[model samples]
Every structure is written in structure tokens, then in C-alpha cells.
Target: MAQHWIATRPGDLEVFSFEPYDAPAPRSGEVTIEVRAAGMNPADAKHVARGRDEDFPRPIGYEVAGVVTAVGPDTEIGSGTVTVGDEVLAFRISGGWASEVTVAASAVFAKPASLSFAEAANLLLAATTAAEMLHVTGVGEGDTILVHGASGAVGVSVLQQAAMLGARAIGTASGSSFGVVERFGGTPVAYGDGLEQRVRDAAPDGVVAALDCVGTDEAVDVSLATVADRSRIVTIAAPDRAKDEGFIAIAGALPESQAYRDSVRADLVRLAGEGRLVVPVARTFALADAVEATELLMGAHPGGKLALEP
Candidate 1:
């Protein structure tokens, strides 16, 4: 038996309950894992807070690192990519908060030996979001970009990936987190009342694109003032403002984003394995302590990733 978090209806983290489960035998092309660590993202809590379909008791997590325990019978042998006993990381897998999960073989990747289970579990979604944002904005060598909330998870990934692409990145952070942004190879600018002017001062050459991880009116206003092309501004945080605000928004709700994520999944895996990509785990809690971990994640910025160890 395994235990996992689930919500019967949307409300708050309090709506989630731990329930025991048994993994049914996987069908062909599926693999089952003994989840070692699960990564927590705002999306996990947001789904419950915003509500979902009438489906009761839906699983609550999205990514995890674990060891393979079973492989389903399949003529194609998709499980050949991994086998029983191999350590792995799986992303975008629904219900990943469980102590055990069965996922499509294609979604699992080899975990890098250099990274701990906590680090490997947190790498996918943020890094992939960063990659897709760069692609949609056409950011590349010689380009300069501004990243709103650059000290946050997605913002940190954006700064590092932008550097990997040979682009200059200017990151917005609280005065306290400026060092975090600078260490990731981004020019650090404090965000507040004069955010636009701060960004302008940081990038006198001008930024060609902007990625907004903070959905404030201030972030939108500044990006619009600096980047001539609205299409070059993308937000993973504020989807509601994207259409009316004339900026691009990529969310799981969009088909284009789903396809984009699928295409670039392998790249994120490779980057983490090569050590160019890093995920900083601020703290880890026992699986039973999910509520406390989640409260912290949903509250103020924690300076690093929060995860659950099963």
C-alpha cells in the first residue's frame, strides 16, 4: 500500500487528505516507481485552490525522483530506457505525490548521478518553462532580456538557461535576493515602485525580450515600456493578463504549450545531467509533513526549492 495526497474539491490545502493506494498492474508502455522524493510547485496547491472537474480525490503532485520497481509487458519495450532498480526522474505525471506511481515510460528520464533525489525531482517543470519562454521570445546569442522575479524557481531557471544560450539577462529580485540573481549570471535589479527605471538602468543597451514570473501590473508595465514587440514578452504567471495585456502566456491549458513542453523535455534532462542546470533545495520534509511544506511554499519566497521525501 502507498499513501498520497488528494483533494475531493477545490478550497485550500486543508482540502487535501492523505489516502492509502495500491498501484494497479500497469498496461503496456507504462512503468511503476517507488517514489523517493516529490517536488512541490505552486501549481499543486493552485489546482486545489482554483478547483477542478467533479472528479473526486484527484492526486496532487507533478514531478518526482524514484527507483523503478516494475515494467509492464509491451512489445515495443519502452521500458528499455530504464529497468527495475534504475534511479529515475519523472515529470508532468499526474498524482506524483504518492509513495508509488505508474507513469507512461516516455515521461521518465535517467536521474543524473551528480544530483541528489531532491534536486533531480525539482528540475523539470521550471527548466522546461524557461526553455519554452526563450523559444517563443526568440532569445538567443547577443540578445538581452529582463526576467521578473528572477530569484524565484522559474526566474532562476530562465537566467541560467539564458546564459547557456549566450544571452545577457537582467533579473528582478527583492534587495535581499539580489545575490541569488547575480550568482546565476544575471544583472540584479531590485523590484518595487521604480522597477521600470531599475531595469532600464541595469540594461542601458536595452533588453530585446522580457519574461515575467511575477504577475504584477508593475512587471507588465515595465516590459511593455522597454520591449517594442509585445509578442516578445511572455508570462508563465499571469495568464489572465496575457490576452488583454498584449503579451504571450504559456500555460498547461494551451495546446501549443503542451506540445512545446513535450518537444523540449529531453533538453532539460540533458542540461541537468551535464550540470549546467542546478536546482537548489531549501528544505525537505517527510511525506507526512506535506501540509507544512505546502504552507511555506504558498506563503513568502523561501529562497530555494521545497520538496517532500517519501
Candidate 2:
């Protein structure tokens, strides 16, 4: 038996109950992991809030770091690529908060030794989101990119990855978060009224691409004022505005985004292992304390990533 957190319904993270579940059995091309840590994201709760009308008592979590305990028939469990007892990180799995989970082998990767289980657990989704945004926006050398919500998980990743691509990052955040953005290699700008002017003053060379992580009208409006090319501006949030407005809207919910994530997932893991990427962890929670963690994730930016230890 194993334990996991379940939401009886959406919009009720605080009412969750941790319950016992049968150990998972892996099917072909799948593996069973004994979860060590699970990542907490706003999307985990928001997706449930969207509600499928079925799949009640939904298990909540997105990514986890763990040990492989079992593999399906015809699966090479002992292979160095993946093996029993080897530490690894897995993503896009349902019921990920459980003590054990069954996931497709293709979605698993070796966790870097440099990262703790908590940090490794938080890595994949945010890093992949950053990669997808930059790839779609065509950010590169000589480009001045504006990243809204630059202190959040995905925004920080965007700043670091943009720097890796030789692009200048102008990150918008509260004045308190300016240091965070600068550490990630972004020139920090305060986000508020007159955000456009602040960005303009920061990037005198002009902003060529914009990635909006905040999904507010302010972010969208400022992005438009700076980047003339609509194709060069994209928002992971504000899908409605993306449709009514001209800029691109990409999210994990979209088919294009799913394909894009599949292509670059492994590379992101590789970069982290090489120490070229760093994911800061603000806090960790016991699996049973997930409701508290969710509350924090849903409430405000915690200054870094949140993880749950199983």
C-alpha cells in the first residue's frame, strides 16, 4: 500500500485528504517509481479546477523524483539508461503525489547528482516551458527579450535560458524580486503602471521578443508596445487574449505545446545534469502536508520552487 493526496473536487486544495492506495503495476513500456519528492505547481490545481466532469477524487501532482522499483515485461529495467534503485525524475504523470506511480518509460530521465531530490523534482516542467517559449518566439543573439513575472519558476528559467542563447533579458517583477532576476542574468524592471516606459529605458536597443508569464493585461499591452512583430511575442498565460489579440498563445493544454515539450524534454534534463541549469527550491513539504504546500503555491510566489517529499 502507498499514500497519495486527492481532491474530491476542484477549488478546494485545503480540503484534500491523504489516502492509502494499492501499489501501482507497470504495463508495457512503463515503470513503477517509489516517489521521493513531487513538484507543486499552480497548474496542478488549476487543471483540476477546469474539471473533466468525471475522474473524481483526482490525484494531484505533475512531476516527481524517485527510485525505479519495477518495470513492465520486455522493458529493460536493469539497463543503465534506467534501472531499479537508480534515482530518476519523471513528469506528466497522473497521481504523481502518491508514494508509488506508474509512468511511461519515455517520460523518465536520470536525475543529476548535483541536484537534491527536491530540486530534481521541480526541474522538468518549468525548464521545458521556458525552452518552448524561447523556441516559439525565436529568441537568440542580439535579441532583447522581455519576460514578465521574471521571479516565478518559469520566468526565471526563461531568463537563464535566454541568457544561454545570448539574448538580453529584460525581466519585470516587483522591486523586491529585482535581485532574483539579476541572478538569472536578466536586467530587472518593475512591473506596474508605466511598465512600458520602464522596459524601454532598460532596453534602449529595443525589445525584439516578449514572453509573458504573468498573463495580465498589463503584460500583454507592454509586450505589444515593445515588440512590433506579433510572432515574436507569446504568452503562456492569457489564452483568451492570445485568441482575440494577435500574439501567440502556447500552453501545455495545446497540441503544439505537447509536441514541443516531447522534443526538448530530454535536452533540458541533460543541461541540468551538466550544471548549466539551476532550479532554486524555496521549501519542501512532507507528502501528508501537501495541502499546506498547495496553499502556499496557490497563494503567492514562494521566492523559489516548492516540492513535496514522499
Candidate 3:
């Protein structure tokens, strides 16, 4: 029997419960994974904490890296055909916080040998979100962008991806985390008082776009003060600000964002395979400690991505 984490009802960690489950054989266009590591994201907790009654008893994670245990007849993954015993990572999946899971084959992809199971498991969701932020804002070579919360998971990804786009990123982070932003190729600026001037000092003139990952009022206000084109200002964390201030707000749930993210997965995986992209994991927790793991994730200062090993 495989063990999996689930939420019995809408709430916080209090709702988490583990149960023994029999992972079914993969049907056509499906694949089963013996999960090695499960990716932890704020969405995993946010969705569960605010879910409707009908969403009860739902699984708790969206991505995992593991060995393929079974594949549907003639199943082909994102890059090519899939077979048992192959190392793989899957994203946008259901019930990934498990010892084993059966998911749609389309979500599966080749795991780069260069990355550990933990890193590979955590890659796509944040990377793809960063990619779409840059995409929607028209960021490109030689452009300058500002990133809020550059030391956090999604913010760190934004810094690396922005550099790869040949863009300079002025990142907002705490003083101690300045190294994290610089290591990822961003010019780090401390948050709090005088943030707007710090960003100006880093960029000299102004930034072409602003990507808000922290979603604080300071972040929103700074982005507004610096970037003239409101269309180029995007926030994944501050939906209320985006709605109220007339900037862009996107989520994986949005149809256009979903399509774009799905389209870019293979490319992001290849970048990792080439050792160009990196996912820094701050900590790992046992699968049984999912509630504790989620507490750290919600703490929002894990210093990097967190993973659950099953």
C-alpha cells in the first residue's frame, strides 16, 4: 500500500491526514510514479486552506520527481516515449504528495541527470511562472527588470531566468540574502524604507518591467513608482493590487497562463539538463511530515525551495 497526504476539509495543516491507498495501473495516456521527492509550493497549502466543501479529501501536492513504475500502452512523455524504471519528473499533477501516484502522461518529463530528485521535482512550477512573467511583460535582451522577493522560491527563479534572457534584474531582498540574489545574477537591493531609491541606484535610470513575488504594499508601490508602463508591471502574489491598480495578475489557473506555461516546460527542462538552470533546495522533510513541511513553506523564509521525500 502506498501512503499519501490529503486534506479532509478546507483548513490549514490541521486538516492533513495520511491514508493507505492502492495506486491503480496507468490507463491509456497515464503514468504511475514511485515518488522519490515531492515539490512543496505555497499553492499546495493555499488551495487546501481555502477550498470549498466539495474539494474535501483531495490530495495535497502538484509535482514530484520519481522513478516511473508503469506507463499506459504506447505512452509518450513530453519529450518522447516513457517506460518503467526511467527517472522522471512530473508537474501540474494531482496527488503528488504520495509514495506512489498515477498521473496523466502529458505531465511527465525526463529528469535531468544533473539535478537531484528534489531539485528536479521543484523546477517547472516556479520557473515556468517566471518565464511567463517575463513573456507577458516583453522582457528581452538588454532590458532591465525589477524583482521583489528575489530570495524566495519564485523570486529566485525570476532572477536566474531574467539573467538568461540577457536582462539585468534589480532584486529586492533582505540584507543577508543579498548573496542569493547576486549568485543568481541579480543586483540586490534591500527592502523596507527607501526601496524606490535603492532600485533607482541599482538600475540608474529605470526598469523596463517589474515582477512582484513578495506582493507587499511596498513592492506594489515601488513597482508603480518605477515602471511607467502599467502593462509591464506584473504580480503573481498580489491579485488584489493587480485588480485595484490596473496592472497584470496571472496564476497557473488562468487559461492563457496555463497554455503558455504548458508550452514552455520542455525548454525549461532542457535548460536544467544543460546545467544552465538551477533549483536550490533549502530543506527536505519526510513525506509523513507534510504538515510540518508546509508550515515551513508558509513561513515564507525557508531561504530556498523545500521538498518532501517519500
On TM-score, the candidate that comes out on top is 3
CA lDDT, candidate 3, residue 61: 91
lDDT of 1 by residue, 1-310 (tens): 8999888787887788988999776778888989999999998988788875676568889999999899888612222456688998888788888899998887888887998999988998888888889999999999999999999999999999999999999998998998999999999998888888887888898999999988888898899999999989999887778888778999865799878887787778788889899898899999989999999998999889988998
Off by over 4 Å in 1: 75-80
Superposed Cα RMSD, model 1: 1.4
lDDT by residue (1-310, candidate 2, tens digit) is: 8998887876566547799988668887889999999988888888877766576778888899999998887664322366678898887677788889888887888888888899889998898899999999999897889999999999999988898999999999999998999998999999888899999999998999999998999999999889989999999889898888888999887888988887787788888888888899999989888888888998877999998898
TM-score of predicted structure 2: 0.96
- Write down the RMSD of all candidates, one decimal each: 1.4, 1.6, 0.9
State which candidate has the highest lDDT.
Answer: 3
For residues 1-310, write the lDDT of model 3, one tens digit per residue.
9999999999988899999999999998999999999999999999998899997889989999999999999889877987899999998898999999999999999998999999999999999999999999999999999999998888888888888889999999999999999999999999999999989988897899999997899999999999999999999989999999999999999999999999999999999889888899999999998988888888758888999998
Instruction: For residue 231, give model 1's deviation from the true position in Å.
Output: 1.1
Each model's lDDT comes to 0.87, 0.87, 0.93
Model 2 alpha-carbon miss at residue 99, Å: 1.2
Counting clashing residue pairs in each candidate, in order, gives 0, 0, 0
Models 1 onward score TM values of: 0.97, 0.96, 0.98
Which residue segments of model 2 deviate by more than 4 Å? 76-80
lDDT of 2: 0.87
